[model samples]
Target: MKGPLFYAKILLFGEYGIIKDSKGLAIPYNTYQGALKKSKNLSEVSKKSNENLKKYFDYLVGLETTLVTFRLVEFKKDIEEGMYFDSSIPQGYGVGSSGALVASIYDKYADDKITVLENLTRDKLLKLKQIFSKMESFFHGKSSGLDPLNSYLSLPILINSKDNLEATGIPSQKEGKGAVFLLDSEIIGETEPMVTIFMNKMKNEGFRKMIDEDFAKYTDACIDDFLHGNMKSLFGNVKHLSKVVLDNFKPMIPTAFHKVWQKGIDSNDYYLKLCGSGGGGYILGFTENFEKTKKILKDYKLELVYRF
Candidate 1:
C-alpha cells in the first residue's frame, strides 16, 4: 500500500540563527523523496528500519498525553505485521531519512493531529512542529521538527523569526553557470554532537555578535536575492556566506575538504556551505559560472542542481 509522500528539504540559509529566532528559509528538494510502502518481503535494511520504527512507536505510545496522541493499538498491529518505509532516500545523509518516516507515521497514525489537507495556519504549523519535535526526539536527542515539517508540507518554508514561519514560493532555477549543488561527504554526521559544539560556542558573546551581525546579514541577503531572481546580488551574498561557514563552522567541514573550501574562497571559482549539519553528508556549493567552477574542482565529484 502506498502512503503519503515526504519530500526532502534544503535549509538554504539560517541554520543556527533560526533557533535563536533569526530569519531563515527552507525549500523542498524534490530530487530526493520518500513514502511509506508495505511489502511481504523485507530486505535487511527494511527489517532493521521496521524494528527501529517499532521502538520509536512504543516510545511515542508510552508518552501518551504528555506528548502526541496516536492510535497505538492500530500502530502496534501494523508494526507487528511488518509495515515499513520502502524508500530510495539515503539514511545518515543529513537529508532527513528519519524525518520522512516520522512524518509518514504521523500522517498515517496520529489521532486528531493536524491535517496537511486543511488550510494550515501558523498556529497549526506550530502545533505540528511541537508534535513532530516530540516524535523525532526518539532519533535525535533533540529536534527542531523542521525536517518532518518540511517533508510533511512539501512546501518552501520561510522562517521570519523563531516563532514565525510560513510556506513560501521561491524563484525557479534558471539555466546558467550559477547553480546550487551537493557534494557528498561519504560519511554520516550525527546531529547531537554537532549541536553540542554549536551550543558550547554560543556561550561566548563574540560568537553571538558574529552570528547576528555577519552570518545573519549575508544569509538574509542571499535568501532575498535568490527569491527576487537577483543573480548578481545573490552570488555576492553567497560568497560572504561561504566565507562565514568556513570561518565559524570549521569543525563541521569535512577535514579532507578544507583545501577545496579554501580554494573556492580564494579563487572565487565557487563557495561551499554545509548542506545539513555538516560533519558529513553533502556540502552545498554555489558558483557564478558552472563550467569554470567545474574545471577548477574537476578532480572532486560534482552534482549541479541549477544553472545561470
Candidate 2:
C-alpha cells in the first residue's frame, strides 16, 4: 500500500519571528517529498522509519488533545504490516522531513480528518494548525505546526500572525536576474538546540528589543514586498533582514559560513537568511543577479527556488 506524496516546505519569512506572533510565509518545495508505503522486504532505511513511526504512534495514543485524534488501531496495524515512510526529504535539514511524515499520517489515519478539499475558512485553518501542532510535537519538542499545515494544504500560506493565516498566492515565478535559492550548508541542524539558543537569547532585554524593533519589522516588510511582487523593495528589505539575522541570530548560523554570509551583504550580490532553525541546514539566499551570485558562490551547492 502506498499513500499520496507530501512535499517539503520552506518558511520563506518569519523563522523565529512567527513564534512571537509575527507574520510568516511558507511555500511548498516540491524538490523533495515523502509518502507512506508498505513492503514485505524492508530496506534498512525503511526499517528505521518503521521503528520511528511505532514510537510516534505510541505517543499519539497517549496524547490527550482536543484538536484531533488519530485512528491508532489502524495506524498500528499498518506499522505491523511493515509500513514505512519512503522519503527523499533530508531529516534535520529544516526542510520539513518530519512535517511531511506527520501530514501523511494525518492524511491517512486521522479520525474525522479535515479534508484538503474543504473551504478552509480561517477558523478551519487555525484548527488544522492546532491539530498539526499537537501531532508534530512528537518530532519537534515544540511546533507551530506550519510545516505540516503547508504540506497538507500544498498551498502557499500567508501567516498574518500566529492565529491568523490563510492560503495566499505569491507572485509568479519569472525568468530574470534576481532569484531566491537554497544554499546547502552540508551540515545537519538539530532544531532543539537551536531553539534553545533562541530561548536563552530571549532572556536578554537587548535581544528582545531587537526582535521587536528590527527583526520583526524587516521580516514583515519582506513578506509584504514578496507577496506584492515588489522585487526592488523586497531586495532592499531582505538585505536589512539578513544583516539583522547576522548580528542578532549569529549563534543560529553555522560558524564556518559567517564570512560568506557577510560577504553577500558586503558585496550586495546576495543575502542569506535562515531556512529553518539555521544551526546548519540549507541557508536561504536571495540574489539580485542569479548568475553573478552563483559565480561568486561557485564552491557551494545552490538550488534555485524562484526567479524574479
Candidate 3:
C-alpha cells in the first residue's frame, strides 16, 4: 500500500549559520517527494531500499527512548515483504531526501505519532523536532532534525534559534521580476564529512567570531526580509550572505562553481549561495530579473522555487 507523500524541503536561509543559532527559514519543495510502498518482486533499487530499511528497523528497535516508539512487529513484517521508499528527491543534493524517508516511516509506524492536524504548540513542535533529531541521526550521523520536521509538517518553518523554531507563514509568491532558484551542481555531498569540517573550523577563534558576527547578522536579516516580503532588503542581505559564504565557506562550495559563484556577485545578475551543506548538491540562486538571469545562465539547469 502507498502512504501519504512527504515533500522535499529547502533551507532558504541559514545553512551553516543555523548550527550557530542563526535565524533560518525552510519551505516545502513539492517538485519532489517520497512515499512508502511494497512490491512482491523487488527491483534492484527497491531491493536496496528494502535492505536499508531493515537496518533502520534494527536501529529503531535498539534506540532507548521514551519520546517515541514504533510498531516493530508490523514494521518488521512490512520490511520482510519488500517495503521500500519510492522517491524522486535526490540524495546528497541537500533537499532532504532522507528526511522524507524518515518522515514516512515515522508517519506509518510510530505509536502516539504527532499528527499534522493537531494544534502544534511551541512545546509540541520542539518535541517533534527532538524526536526527529533522534530518529534522523541514524542517517546524518548528527542531525538538527529541521529537515524531517519541515517534510512532516509540509509548512514553512522559521528558526529563531536552535530552541525556538515554529511553523511560519511566508508571504505568498508574487509574480514579479525577482525569484529564488536552485542550480544543480550534479555532485553528491557527504553530510558527515562536511559537518566534520565545519566543527573543526569552529575550533578556530577567527572562524567562530566571523560566524557569530557576519554570518548570523546577514542570515537573520534575510529571514526577516523574506517573511515580510521586503524584496529590496532581502536581495541586499542575500548578496551579503552569498559573499560571506563564498569568502569563508570555500571548502563547502564545490570547486567547479567557485568561478560561477563569484561571477554572480560581480555581475549583480544573480547571487548564489549554498542550498544545504554545499560541497556539491544544489546551489541556491537569487535574481532580481528572472528573464535576464535565465538568458545569462542558459548553460545551467535553473529550477524556479519562489517568485518575489
- Model 1, range 132-251, lDDT digits (tens) per residue? 888888888988888898888888888888577788888876665678877777888877888889989989999988998999899899889887889888878988988988899999
CA deviation > 4 Å runs, candidate 3? none
- TM-score of the candidate numbered 1? 0.95
Cα lDDT tens digits for candidate 2, 123-200: 999999999999888888999999999999999999998899999999889878899999999999999888999999
In model 1, the clashing pairs are 21-162, 176-307, 176-308, 177-308
Cα-lDDT of candidate 3: 0.93
**Model 3 per-residue lDDT at 176:** 91
lDDT score for candidate 2 against the true structure: 0.94
RMSD of 2: 0.7
Per-candidate RMSD, Å: 1.6, 0.7, 0.7
- The local distance difference test score of each candidate is 0.82, 0.94, 0.93
Candidate 1 lowest-lDDT run of ten: 61-70
